[model samples]
Target: MDLRIIWFWMVGILIIGYAILDGFDFGVGILSLFARDEKERRLHMNAIGPVWDGNEVWLLTGGGALFAAFPVVYAAVFSGFYIALMLLLAALIFRAVSFEFRGKVDSSVWRRVWDLAFGIGSLLPAVLFGVAIGNILHGVPIDASGTDVGSFLEMLNPFSIGVGVLSLVLFVMHGAIYLADKSEGDLQTRCRTRASQAWMLFVVLYIVMTIWSWIGSPFLFENSLQNPLFYILFVVLIGAIVFLPIVLKSGKMGRAFLISSLLIAAMLGEMALSLFPRLVPSSIDLSNSLTIYNASSTPLTLKTMLIIALIGIPCVIGYSVFIHYVFRGKIELTEESY
Candidate 1:
């Protein structure tokens, strides 16, 4: 197999890992904001505190893979989405800070401030990430010089906004299911109820976005139709999402979470299939678009990275698996809890 394709799969896998892992992080944070009391808030925070930072490693790994394998795409995307990425970085930074500071002061006022920061921090990234994906799918103004030519705000079209909303709702649902799994008593019931509500909202948004994507960018569906194998993945993705609520209602929290995670993987898989060969589609001129062949580094570089990744990625995965296994099951808060 070509190293280019190998590296592309590596990048995609890392992204999927991040999507499944950090997704719940945002979900928990968003849910925490609506907690009825400090104890409930503490429960929410503790539910994720053990694994949230570890989940972030997937994100970093994905970015690093992109930089190593497709430096041009990395540069083009980062430079184009400069402001948006900065804002995301800011949110993540402050959110991390809130984890430590939210409990530092005994006063309710200080905790409230940090709690708001955590929610906004989590919310911004969730929406912005979807918007970024929307812009990519919708195509951005990229010059032949391989640069994003549009303004930052230009990424906020109606299509992207819709996608952003869907992302937010999707994460909320994911987080709710997680909380429902890890919590008991009234809190567990609330989590389940919120998960149901989020799922309903997600179904509506998903329908709207799918329709909009089909109408606005018929090529997404058309191109998928051209690929028989990928079309199957598309079907499975839709099936998993549609079946999510059923699983939730059946009291299968673990299976429900898997379904949501599968949906994320399948959706990304579909996007990868749609955008295969092309790295970033140029709105200015389709000819100016970046492709795997056009945007990737030298074969030697790719080969070297593939070798390193084959060794390192597994270790990362092993560590992630170990961490999750160690932290598995319900969360219990104590005086020392975050």
Candidate 2:
């Protein structure tokens, strides 16, 4: 296989890993805002407290892989999304601070403030990430220099906003299922109810987004339709979407959570399939687009990184699995708990 193609899938795998992992973390934070009281809120926080930071490692690794494998795409995307990236960064920082500070002051007011920060932090990233993916799929205006020429406001068109909402709803649903699995009693019931509601909304928005994408970017579908893997992933996505509600109704929260994660992975997989070869499509001129062949680092560089990744990625996967196994169970709040 070509090194560029290999690196492309490697980058996609890291990103999908991040989305599946931290995605629920964001969802938990957003849902925590609706908790009935302080104990409930703390329960939400403690539910993810054990693993949230580690989840973010996937994002860091994804970005690093992109930078190393496709410097041109990294430079262009970061430069184009500078302000948006800054906002995301600030939100994540505040969210991290909220976990530690929310437990500190003992004052209800302070806790509330941090709680709000955490929710907003989670919310912004959920939406922003979707918007970014939407723009990439929809095509941005890039010049011959491989720089995105579109403004920030231009990035938030109707389609992009719809995708953002879809992302937000999906994450909320994912989070609710996870919370349900980790919680008990009234909170668990509420989480299940929210998950069902969010699933309905996700289905609606997903349909709308699909139509919008077809009308706006028909070219994205051309390659995917011919690819057999795309069909397989699409079937998995549809199956997950259909079975999630049934599983949730069966009082199988853990299975529902797994299905939700699969749904997310399949959705991203489809997106990646659609965008294969092209990392960032150029609306102004297809010739200006950054693609796997044109944007990737040299062959020797890719080979070096592949070797390094082979050694490193498995360690990450093993560590993540070990952490989840150690923390697997219902939430048990204590005086020492965040």
Best by TM-score: 2
Q: lDDT by residue for model 2 over 1-338, one digit each (tens)? A: 99999999999999899988999999999999898998899999999999999999998999999999999999999999888899899999999999999888878889889999999999999998899898998998889999988899998988888888899998899999999999999999999999999999999999989999999988789788999999999999999999999999999998999999999999998999999989998989888989998899999999999999999999999999999999999999988899
Candidate 1 deviates by what RMSD?
1.3
* lDDT scores of the candidates, listed in order: 0.87, 0.93
RMSD (Å) of each candidate, 1 decimal: 1.3, 0.8
What local lDDT score does residue 138 receive in model 1, on the 0 to 100 scale?
A: 78
On lDDT, the leading prediction is 2
Residue 292 displacement (Å), model 2: 0.2
